[model samples]
Target: MTMTRKDIGLATRRAVLGDAHVARAQEATTAFDAPFQDLIAEGAWGRVWTSEAISRRERSMLTIALLAALGHDEELAMHCRATVRTGASAEDVREALMHVAIYAGVPAANRALKIAKAVFAEMAADTDQTDSEKGGDHDKG
Candidate 1:
Protein backbone atom coordinates (compact mmCIF):
# COMPACT_ATOMS: atom_id res chain seq x y z
CA MET A 1 0.00 0.00 0.00
CA THR A 2 1.17 3.49 -0.74
CA MET A 3 2.03 5.52 2.33
CA THR A 4 0.18 8.80 2.89
CA ARG A 5 2.01 12.09 3.29
CA LYS A 6 1.52 12.01 7.03
CA ASP A 7 2.84 8.48 7.21
CA ILE A 8 5.90 9.35 5.14
CA GLY A 9 6.42 12.49 7.17
CA LEU A 10 6.09 10.73 10.49
CA ALA A 11 8.65 8.12 9.48
CA THR A 12 11.07 10.73 8.20
CA ARG A 13 10.55 12.90 11.25
CA ARG A 14 11.12 10.05 13.68
CA ALA A 15 14.21 8.93 11.81
CA VAL A 16 15.80 12.35 11.85
CA LEU A 17 14.62 13.73 15.19
CA GLY A 18 14.50 10.45 17.15
CA ASP A 19 11.39 8.72 18.51
CA ALA A 20 11.50 10.33 21.96
CA HIS A 21 11.54 13.86 20.64
CA VAL A 22 8.83 13.18 18.08
CA ALA A 23 6.71 11.39 20.66
CA ARG A 24 6.98 14.32 23.07
CA ALA A 25 5.95 16.72 20.35
CA GLN A 26 3.00 14.52 19.46
CA GLU A 27 1.93 14.13 23.07
CA ALA A 28 2.12 17.88 23.68
CA THR A 29 0.05 18.80 20.62
CA THR A 30 -2.99 20.81 21.63
CA ALA A 31 -6.14 20.79 19.55
CA PHE A 32 -5.21 24.24 18.27
CA ASP A 33 -1.68 23.27 17.31
CA ALA A 34 -2.47 19.76 16.05
CA PRO A 35 -3.24 20.91 12.54
CA PHE A 36 -0.14 23.05 12.44
CA GLN A 37 1.96 20.05 13.45
CA ASP A 38 0.36 17.92 10.77
CA LEU A 39 1.06 20.59 8.17
CA ILE A 40 4.78 20.65 9.04
CA ALA A 41 4.96 16.84 9.13
CA GLU A 42 3.42 16.54 5.70
CA GLY A 43 5.01 19.57 4.10
CA ALA A 44 8.44 19.85 5.69
CA TRP A 45 9.24 16.30 6.76
CA GLY A 46 7.46 14.48 3.99
CA ARG A 47 8.09 16.74 1.05
CA VAL A 48 11.44 18.24 1.96
CA TRP A 49 13.15 15.77 4.28
CA THR A 50 12.13 12.75 2.24
CA SER A 51 13.64 14.26 -0.87
CA GLU A 52 16.50 12.16 -2.30
CA ALA A 53 18.28 15.05 -3.95
CA ILE A 54 20.15 15.84 -0.76
CA SER A 55 21.73 13.59 1.84
CA ARG A 56 20.34 13.86 5.36
CA ARG A 57 23.70 15.19 6.60
CA GLU A 58 23.63 17.94 4.00
CA ARG A 59 20.02 18.69 4.81
CA SER A 60 20.84 18.88 8.51
CA MET A 61 23.65 21.34 7.84
CA LEU A 62 21.46 23.46 5.57
CA THR A 63 18.63 23.39 8.10
CA ILE A 64 20.91 24.45 10.95
CA ALA A 65 22.22 27.34 8.87
CA LEU A 66 18.75 28.45 7.76
CA LEU A 67 17.32 28.23 11.25
CA ALA A 68 20.31 30.19 12.57
CA ALA A 69 19.90 32.84 9.91
CA LEU A 70 16.19 33.11 10.62
CA GLY A 71 16.87 33.31 14.37
CA HIS A 72 14.73 30.26 15.05
CA ASP A 73 16.65 29.32 18.18
CA GLU A 74 14.46 26.48 19.43
CA GLU A 75 14.31 24.78 16.08
CA LEU A 76 18.03 25.37 15.61
CA ALA A 77 18.74 23.64 18.92
CA MET A 78 16.42 20.76 18.08
CA HIS A 79 18.08 20.31 14.70
CA CYS A 80 21.49 20.46 16.32
CA ARG A 81 20.47 17.49 18.46
CA ALA A 82 19.13 15.73 15.39
CA THR A 83 22.56 16.04 13.78
CA VAL A 84 23.71 12.94 15.68
CA ARG A 85 21.16 10.94 13.76
CA THR A 86 21.74 12.90 10.54
CA GLY A 87 25.53 12.35 10.49
CA ALA A 88 26.33 16.05 10.62
CA SER A 89 29.44 16.54 12.73
CA ALA A 90 29.97 19.21 15.39
CA GLU A 91 32.54 20.74 13.08
CA ASP A 92 29.92 20.83 10.34
CA VAL A 93 27.58 22.66 12.70
CA ARG A 94 30.31 25.15 13.54
CA GLU A 95 30.97 25.81 9.86
CA ALA A 96 27.26 26.31 9.20
CA LEU A 97 26.96 28.71 12.12
CA MET A 98 29.99 30.60 10.84
CA HIS A 99 28.26 30.96 7.51
CA VAL A 100 25.22 32.20 9.36
CA ALA A 101 27.40 34.78 11.11
CA ILE A 102 28.71 36.07 7.79
CA TYR A 103 25.37 36.15 5.99
CA ALA A 104 22.84 36.60 8.76
CA GLY A 105 24.54 38.68 11.50
CA VAL A 106 27.08 38.22 14.26
CA PRO A 107 24.40 38.29 16.96
CA ALA A 108 22.23 35.69 15.28
CA ALA A 109 25.11 33.31 14.69
CA ASN A 110 26.41 33.89 18.19
CA ARG A 111 23.07 32.93 19.69
CA ALA A 112 22.76 29.93 17.38
CA LEU A 113 26.23 28.72 18.33
CA LYS A 114 25.36 28.97 21.97
CA ILE A 115 22.25 26.92 21.42
CA ALA A 116 24.20 24.40 19.37
CA LYS A 117 26.79 24.06 22.11
CA ALA A 118 24.12 23.34 24.70
CA VAL A 119 22.52 20.73 22.49
CA PHE A 120 25.87 19.11 21.86
CA ALA A 121 26.55 18.96 25.57
CA GLU A 122 23.18 17.38 26.19
CA MET A 123 23.79 14.81 23.47
CA ALA A 124 27.21 13.96 24.83
CA ALA A 125 25.81 13.51 28.30
CA ASP A 126 23.08 11.25 27.00
CA THR A 127 25.64 9.12 25.21
CA ASP A 128 27.78 8.91 28.28
CA GLN A 129 24.85 7.78 30.38
CA THR A 130 23.82 5.19 27.84
CA ASP A 131 27.36 3.93 27.57
CA SER A 132 27.65 3.64 31.30
CA GLU A 133 24.37 1.79 31.49
CA LYS A 134 25.59 -0.61 28.84
CA GLY A 135 28.82 -1.27 30.80
CA GLY A 136 30.74 0.26 27.96
CA ASP A 137 34.57 0.73 27.91
CA HIS A 138 35.04 0.42 31.65
CA ASP A 139 34.21 -3.28 31.47
CA LYS A 140 37.00 -3.77 28.95
CA GLY A 141 39.65 -2.28 31.19
Candidate 2:
Protein backbone atom coordinates (compact mmCIF):
# COMPACT_ATOMS: atom_id res chain seq x y z
CA MET A 1 0.00 0.00 0.00
CA THR A 2 1.09 3.53 -0.73
CA MET A 3 2.05 5.50 2.34
CA THR A 4 -0.04 8.53 3.16
CA ARG A 5 1.72 11.80 3.94
CA LYS A 6 0.87 11.57 7.59
CA ASP A 7 1.90 7.94 7.72
CA ILE A 8 5.19 8.68 6.03
CA GLY A 9 5.79 11.57 8.36
CA LEU A 10 4.90 9.58 11.44
CA ALA A 11 7.07 6.59 10.63
CA THR A 12 9.96 8.57 9.25
CA ARG A 13 10.01 10.87 12.25
CA ARG A 14 9.70 8.13 14.80
CA ALA A 15 12.38 6.02 13.12
CA VAL A 16 15.00 8.71 12.62
CA LEU A 17 14.34 10.40 15.94
CA GLY A 18 11.43 10.22 18.35
CA ASP A 19 7.81 11.25 18.75
CA ALA A 20 8.56 14.43 20.70
CA HIS A 21 11.09 15.59 18.10
CA VAL A 22 8.72 14.87 15.22
CA ALA A 23 5.91 16.64 17.03
CA ARG A 24 8.01 19.76 17.33
CA ALA A 25 8.93 19.59 13.65
CA GLN A 26 5.29 19.23 12.70
CA GLU A 27 4.40 22.18 14.91
CA ALA A 28 7.19 24.33 13.51
CA THR A 29 6.37 23.65 9.87
CA THR A 30 4.55 26.77 8.68
CA ALA A 31 2.05 27.47 5.94
CA PHE A 32 4.81 28.66 3.64
CA ASP A 33 6.81 25.44 3.99
CA ALA A 34 3.90 23.10 4.39
CA PRO A 35 4.42 21.79 0.89
CA PHE A 36 8.17 21.55 1.41
CA GLN A 37 7.49 19.79 4.67
CA ASP A 38 5.32 17.30 2.87
CA LEU A 39 8.03 16.74 0.34
CA ILE A 40 10.57 16.15 3.09
CA ALA A 41 8.18 13.85 4.83
CA GLU A 42 8.04 11.72 1.71
CA GLY A 43 11.56 12.13 0.37
CA ALA A 44 14.06 12.80 3.15
CA TRP A 45 12.19 11.54 6.17
CA GLY A 46 10.49 8.65 4.45
CA ARG A 47 13.39 7.42 2.38
CA VAL A 48 16.60 8.42 4.10
CA TRP A 49 16.03 9.43 7.69
CA THR A 50 14.27 6.16 8.41
CA SER A 51 17.25 4.06 7.45
CA GLU A 52 18.39 1.64 10.13
CA ALA A 53 22.09 1.91 9.47
CA ILE A 54 22.56 4.78 11.88
CA SER A 55 21.27 5.72 15.28
CA ARG A 56 19.15 8.81 15.80
CA ARG A 57 21.78 10.43 18.00
CA GLU A 58 24.40 9.86 15.36
CA ARG A 59 22.11 11.24 12.70
CA SER A 60 21.44 14.30 14.81
CA MET A 61 25.13 15.04 15.35
CA LEU A 62 26.06 14.40 11.73
CA THR A 63 23.17 16.46 10.36
CA ILE A 64 24.06 19.45 12.55
CA ALA A 65 27.76 19.23 11.76
CA LEU A 66 27.19 18.96 8.04
CA LEU A 67 24.64 21.77 7.98
CA ALA A 68 27.10 23.96 9.85
CA ALA A 69 29.94 23.04 7.53
CA LEU A 70 27.81 23.83 4.50
CA GLY A 71 26.70 27.19 5.96
CA HIS A 72 23.05 26.12 5.95
CA ASP A 73 22.23 28.24 8.94
CA GLU A 74 18.46 27.86 8.75
CA GLU A 75 18.63 24.10 8.37
CA LEU A 76 21.26 23.97 11.09
CA ALA A 77 18.97 25.86 13.39
CA MET A 78 16.08 23.53 12.61
CA HIS A 79 18.18 20.45 13.31
CA CYS A 80 19.48 21.99 16.49
CA ARG A 81 15.91 22.41 17.64
CA ALA A 82 15.26 18.78 16.74
CA THR A 83 18.33 17.73 18.69
CA VAL A 84 16.36 18.16 21.89
CA ARG A 85 13.99 15.44 20.75
CA THR A 86 16.82 13.32 19.42
CA GLY A 87 18.27 13.07 22.91
CA ALA A 88 21.24 15.26 22.11
CA SER A 89 22.55 17.62 24.74
CA ALA A 90 23.94 21.13 24.41
CA GLU A 91 27.29 19.61 25.30
CA ASP A 92 27.00 17.32 22.30
CA VAL A 93 26.34 20.33 20.09
CA ARG A 94 29.37 22.11 21.56
CA GLU A 95 31.54 19.12 20.82
CA ALA A 96 30.15 18.83 17.32
CA LEU A 97 30.85 22.48 16.61
CA MET A 98 34.36 22.10 17.94
CA HIS A 99 34.90 19.33 15.44
CA VAL A 100 33.32 21.46 12.74
CA ALA A 101 35.73 24.27 13.61
CA ILE A 102 38.65 21.96 13.10
CA TYR A 103 37.37 20.19 10.03
CA ALA A 104 35.08 22.73 8.41
CA GLY A 105 36.99 25.92 9.42
CA VAL A 106 36.67 28.36 12.25
CA PRO A 107 34.45 30.80 10.41
CA ALA A 108 31.83 28.21 9.57
CA ALA A 109 31.82 26.89 13.12
CA ASN A 110 31.60 30.44 14.44
CA ARG A 111 28.52 31.17 12.39
CA ALA A 112 26.97 27.86 13.31
CA LEU A 113 27.51 28.57 16.98
CA LYS A 114 25.80 31.91 16.66
CA ILE A 115 22.87 30.30 14.91
CA ALA A 116 22.62 27.52 17.45
CA LYS A 117 22.77 29.98 20.31
CA ALA A 118 19.82 31.89 18.95
CA VAL A 119 17.86 28.72 18.31
CA PHE A 120 18.58 27.55 21.84
CA ALA A 121 17.42 30.84 23.27
CA GLU A 122 14.22 30.59 21.31
CA MET A 123 13.69 27.07 22.57
CA ALA A 124 14.17 28.26 26.13
CA ALA A 125 11.56 30.95 25.59
CA ASP A 126 9.14 28.41 24.17
CA THR A 127 9.63 26.23 27.21
CA ASP A 128 9.09 29.17 29.53
CA GLN A 129 5.89 30.01 27.71
CA THR A 130 4.66 26.44 28.10
CA ASP A 131 5.45 26.50 31.81
CA SER A 132 3.60 29.78 32.26
CA GLU A 133 0.61 28.38 30.42
CA LYS A 134 0.61 25.37 32.67
CA GLY A 135 0.82 27.63 35.69
CA GLY A 136 -2.13 29.61 34.45
CA ASP A 137 -4.11 26.44 34.02
CA HIS A 138 -3.24 25.38 37.56
CA ASP A 139 -4.37 28.75 38.90
CA LYS A 140 -7.65 28.45 37.05
CA GLY A 141 -8.17 25.00 38.55
Candidate 3:
Protein backbone atom coordinates (compact mmCIF):
# COMPACT_ATOMS: atom_id res chain seq x y z
CA MET A 1 0.00 0.00 0.00
CA THR A 2 1.20 3.46 -0.76
CA MET A 3 1.68 5.78 2.17
CA THR A 4 -0.10 9.10 2.15
CA ARG A 5 1.54 12.45 2.85
CA LYS A 6 0.21 12.39 6.40
CA ASP A 7 1.66 8.96 6.90
CA ILE A 8 5.03 10.01 5.55
CA GLY A 9 4.96 13.16 7.63
CA LEU A 10 3.93 11.43 10.84
CA ALA A 11 6.74 8.92 10.40
CA THR A 12 9.26 11.65 9.69
CA ARG A 13 8.02 13.62 12.68
CA ARG A 14 8.39 10.60 14.93
CA ALA A 15 11.86 9.89 13.61
CA VAL A 16 12.98 13.46 14.25
CA LEU A 17 11.17 14.17 17.53
CA GLY A 18 10.57 10.61 18.86
CA ASP A 19 7.35 8.72 19.57
CA ALA A 20 6.75 10.11 23.04
CA HIS A 21 6.73 13.70 21.86
CA VAL A 22 4.48 12.85 18.98
CA ALA A 23 2.17 10.97 21.28
CA ARG A 24 1.87 13.96 23.54
CA ALA A 25 0.97 16.22 20.68
CA GLN A 26 -1.53 13.71 19.35
CA GLU A 27 -3.08 13.30 22.74
CA ALA A 28 -3.44 17.04 23.08
CA THR A 29 -4.93 17.54 19.65
CA THR A 30 -8.50 18.83 19.50
CA ALA A 31 -11.06 19.34 16.78
CA PHE A 32 -10.24 23.03 16.54
CA ASP A 33 -6.53 22.51 16.00
CA ALA A 34 -6.73 19.30 14.02
CA PRO A 35 -6.37 21.12 10.72
CA PHE A 36 -3.45 23.11 12.02
CA GLN A 37 -1.78 19.92 13.13
CA ASP A 38 -2.36 18.34 9.77
CA LEU A 39 -0.95 21.36 8.03
CA ILE A 40 2.29 21.12 9.92
CA ALA A 41 2.49 17.37 9.51
CA GLU A 42 2.10 17.67 5.77
CA GLY A 43 4.06 20.85 5.33
CA ALA A 44 6.81 21.12 7.93
CA TRP A 45 7.47 17.45 8.57
CA GLY A 46 6.64 16.09 5.15
CA ARG A 47 7.75 18.75 2.72
CA VAL A 48 10.66 20.31 4.57
CA TRP A 49 11.95 17.81 7.10
CA THR A 50 11.51 14.84 4.79
CA SER A 51 13.49 16.47 2.02
CA GLU A 52 16.88 14.93 1.18
CA ALA A 53 18.58 18.21 0.42
CA ILE A 54 20.35 18.26 3.79
CA SER A 55 21.16 15.99 6.69
CA ARG A 56 18.99 15.97 9.76
CA ARG A 57 21.92 17.26 11.82
CA GLU A 58 22.30 20.25 9.54
CA ARG A 59 18.55 20.78 9.53
CA SER A 60 18.52 20.70 13.31
CA MET A 61 21.16 23.40 13.51
CA LEU A 62 19.40 25.53 10.94
CA THR A 63 16.08 25.15 12.71
CA ILE A 64 17.71 26.11 15.97
CA ALA A 65 19.17 29.26 14.49
CA LEU A 66 15.87 30.26 12.90
CA LEU A 67 13.88 29.56 16.05
CA ALA A 68 16.36 31.57 18.10
CA ALA A 69 16.38 34.48 15.67
CA LEU A 70 12.61 34.54 15.54
CA GLY A 71 12.39 34.51 19.34
CA HIS A 72 10.39 31.30 19.41
CA ASP A 73 11.56 30.37 22.88
CA GLU A 74 9.37 27.33 23.41
CA GLU A 75 10.12 25.80 20.05
CA LEU A 76 13.78 26.77 20.37
CA ALA A 77 14.10 24.87 23.66
CA MET A 78 12.28 21.85 22.25
CA HIS A 79 14.67 21.69 19.29
CA CYS A 80 17.58 21.89 21.67
CA ARG A 81 16.16 18.85 23.47
CA ALA A 82 15.86 17.12 20.11
CA THR A 83 19.55 17.56 19.26
CA VAL A 84 20.42 14.15 20.65
CA ARG A 85 18.07 12.53 18.16
CA THR A 86 19.13 14.91 15.39
CA GLY A 87 22.86 14.29 16.03
CA ALA A 88 23.41 18.00 16.52
CA SER A 89 26.03 18.32 19.20
CA ALA A 90 26.00 21.08 21.77
CA GLU A 91 28.98 22.58 19.97
CA ASP A 92 26.93 22.68 16.79
CA VAL A 93 24.21 24.56 18.63
CA ARG A 94 26.79 26.95 20.07
CA GLU A 95 28.10 27.74 16.63
CA ALA A 96 24.61 28.14 15.22
CA LEU A 97 23.65 30.53 17.97
CA MET A 98 26.83 32.48 17.33
CA HIS A 99 25.51 33.08 13.84
CA VAL A 100 22.22 34.10 15.34
CA ALA A 101 24.04 36.62 17.52
CA ILE A 102 25.85 38.14 14.57
CA TYR A 103 23.12 38.06 11.96
CA ALA A 104 20.06 38.23 14.21
CA GLY A 105 20.86 39.91 17.53
CA VAL A 106 22.78 39.39 20.76
CA PRO A 107 19.69 39.04 22.94
CA ALA A 108 18.18 36.26 20.87
CA ALA A 109 21.35 34.22 20.93
CA ASN A 110 21.80 34.81 24.65
CA ARG A 111 18.33 33.50 25.39
CA ALA A 112 18.82 30.52 23.10
CA LEU A 113 22.11 29.70 24.84
CA LYS A 114 20.41 29.62 28.22
CA ILE A 115 17.67 27.38 26.87
CA ALA A 116 20.16 25.05 25.20
CA LYS A 117 22.32 24.84 28.33
CA ALA A 118 19.35 23.96 30.49
CA VAL A 119 18.11 21.34 28.07
CA PHE A 120 21.56 19.74 27.73
CA ALA A 121 21.95 19.62 31.49
CA GLU A 122 18.61 17.86 31.79
CA MET A 123 19.53 15.38 29.06
CA ALA A 124 22.84 14.64 30.80
CA ALA A 125 21.07 14.05 34.08
CA ASP A 126 18.66 11.66 32.39
CA THR A 127 21.59 9.82 30.85
CA ASP A 128 23.40 9.64 34.17
CA GLN A 129 20.31 8.30 35.84
CA THR A 130 19.81 5.67 33.19
CA ASP A 131 23.46 4.62 33.41
CA SER A 132 23.26 4.34 37.17
CA GLU A 133 20.12 2.27 36.84
CA LYS A 134 21.98 -0.12 34.53
CA GLY A 135 24.95 -0.29 36.91
CA GLY A 136 27.36 1.06 34.26
CA ASP A 137 29.04 4.36 33.54
CA HIS A 138 27.73 4.57 30.02
CA ASP A 139 28.12 7.92 28.36
CA LYS A 140 25.34 9.26 26.17
CA GLY A 141 25.11 12.16 23.75
Task: Report lDDT (CA) for all predictions.
Answer: 0.94, 0.85, 0.94
Task: Please say which candidate is ahead in lDDT: 1 or 3.
Answer: 1
What's the C-alpha lDDT at position 115 in model 2? 91
lDDT of 2 at 69: 98
RMSD of each: 2.3, 4.7, 3.6
Using TM-score as the measure, the top candidate is 3
Best by lDDT: 1
Q: Go through the candidates in order and give the clash count of each.
A: 0, 0, 0
**Could you tell me how far off, in angstroms, the CA of residue 108 lies in candidate 3 after the best superposition?**
0.4
Q: What does the lDDT read for residue 15 in candidate 3?
A: 89
| lDDT (Cα, tens digit) per residue for candidate 3, span 1-141 | 998888899999998888999999999999999999999999999889999999999999999999999999999988998888899999999999999999999999999999999999999999999879777534442
lDDT of 2: 0.85
Clash-forming residue pairs, model 2:
none
* Candidate 1 deviant stretches above 4 angstroms: 136-141
Deviating ranges (above 4 Å) for candidate 3 = 136-141
Q: Looking at model 2, how many pairs of residues clash?
A: 0
